[model samples]
Target: MEWRGRRQSSNIEDRRAEGPVGGGFGGSGPGGGFRIPVGSGRGGGLSIGTIIFLVVIYFVFKAMGIDLLQVVSGGQPTPAGYERSAQESSPGEEDTKAFVATVLAETEDTWNGIFKANGETYREPRLVLFRNAIQSACGNASAASGPFYCPADQKVYLDMSFFDELSQRFKASGDFAQAYVVAHEVGHHVQNLLGILPKVNEQRQNMSEAQSNQMSVRTELQADCFAGIWGKYTQQKGLLEQGDLEEALNAATQIGDDTLQRRTQGYVVPESFNHGTSQQRSTWFKRGFDSGQLSACDTFNNPV
Candidate 1:
């Protein structure tokens, strides 16, 4: 939480000013761009009656891989109306940015040491900042998709607005919770470095949907454990304060697929869960925190 004076990672890609760059499959325009007809109500779009509803639905559909623009245009990317613009970051946002960079640097230090201990060198991954949307080697992403690490590009993508949603919507406030998010994504980078992500993804091709979801759960749980490992490292360095662990645990609970599904849909589907349950998430995180050993994060071999 107290990360103001800490080191910041230089591996940050400040693409916020770049807007959404194009480059996805079957898209058109100069930069492969596209646009969703907002409540402009122009050209037979929805009326103002369900403007807010439609906006929410749009993002939800986008998250579920239903690109409205692509669907409407038959896979043609439309040009952006506005030019690339950069907004001046507020003081709080600037501090948050610095905090993210600091957390990333610490993860780099921790993982580098960990890899060196195992006779390997850790290759640091870049963290990208963007607004609205960003294109990754894996695919195009919107902020609604949440933070993610793309192994294909060896980069982590984040939208800081998620922090506000974390605090206000999920009720998982606190600097530690924010740190946990960054650490969890970085954990994916670690898995990529170790070739675990590629192997698991390759195997998923042969798995049924349910079985693949189970594999994804294991992978996600391991990443949670890895984040806990970072927490353990910070705790050992006397960086953790009171209530920090609770913040992280609360965050894990709030973001559990079951918890989120229940909150949004008033129901839970266990088999559809790609991430673990709330208990599993918190438990695996605690396992790594208490043990502070990479061996303790073997969610695959062990009963998770």
Candidate 2:
């Protein structure tokens, strides 16, 4: 994406290449203590995650009179030392930081335009660039947690090296692909502003595991569609070069929950899924791309 001249968002916090991993995320912010796991995070590198979504599910459902043990079978906790701070960046790391900053700026602009078009004000989401691990209002998380949005904090967390997972592991590479990931998280921020996230979470609390996963798939697919909205605006402003859309589409397919689950675990279980399948992801994104209208991206009202 051609993001050079855009306005960089002040909401971005440059925590990318600093501090060791594994510090306490609890009480790290003002007026905290809200326990919720916004999304299922991928562990970056070797650092394990201390607070997984299952724990969050357990605690969140405890409040709703649901036993998490019934739904969350078992998964090993992320190893210790996973929470340590990240090492200092090398000399060339500045370029990567700038790229991420530029991406944030683009998302800010695109979303701002979108909000204005709908006659509503935009509430920018903060982007936290951390090292191995960082503390959030939702919980303490490691880079292994990959990128996630904490609705409680209204912030987006990312460890840029996930680009590696995107490129080397998932085989989805290119600058635009990386930018797609950022846009997707910002899309969640959009959902939060639209009051879609809280309601979905509430509904999920009373749902069976299969039902909750279905809701999550809808949520994730909508975010993908939102990301497509951002892409449409950017492309209109002359950001598209040949293959840019393919890069983004590849990214959407690469991160599909079903695809990730099949690779991370042994097989795919539709009912246990959080993010949608690759086909659903690709389809929703294309829906948003084809029709740049935000309303067109409603995965909840219309089945995906």
Report the number of the highest-lDDT candidate. 1
Candidate 1 residue 86 C-alpha distance from true site, Å: 4.5
Residue 42: error of model 2 in Å?
Answer: 14
**Model 1 pairs in collision:** 28-77, 34-78
lDDT of 1 at 150: 81
| Top candidate (TM-score) | 1
Report how far residue 264 has shifted in candidate 2, in Å.
2.8
TM-score of 2: 0.77
- TM-score for each prediction? 0.81, 0.77
Positional deviation of residue 59's Cα in model 1 after best superposition, in angstroms = 19
Q: Over 4 Å off in model 2, which ranges? A: 21-88
Per-residue CA lDDT of model 2 for 10-36, tens digit only, reads 777877535533232322222221111
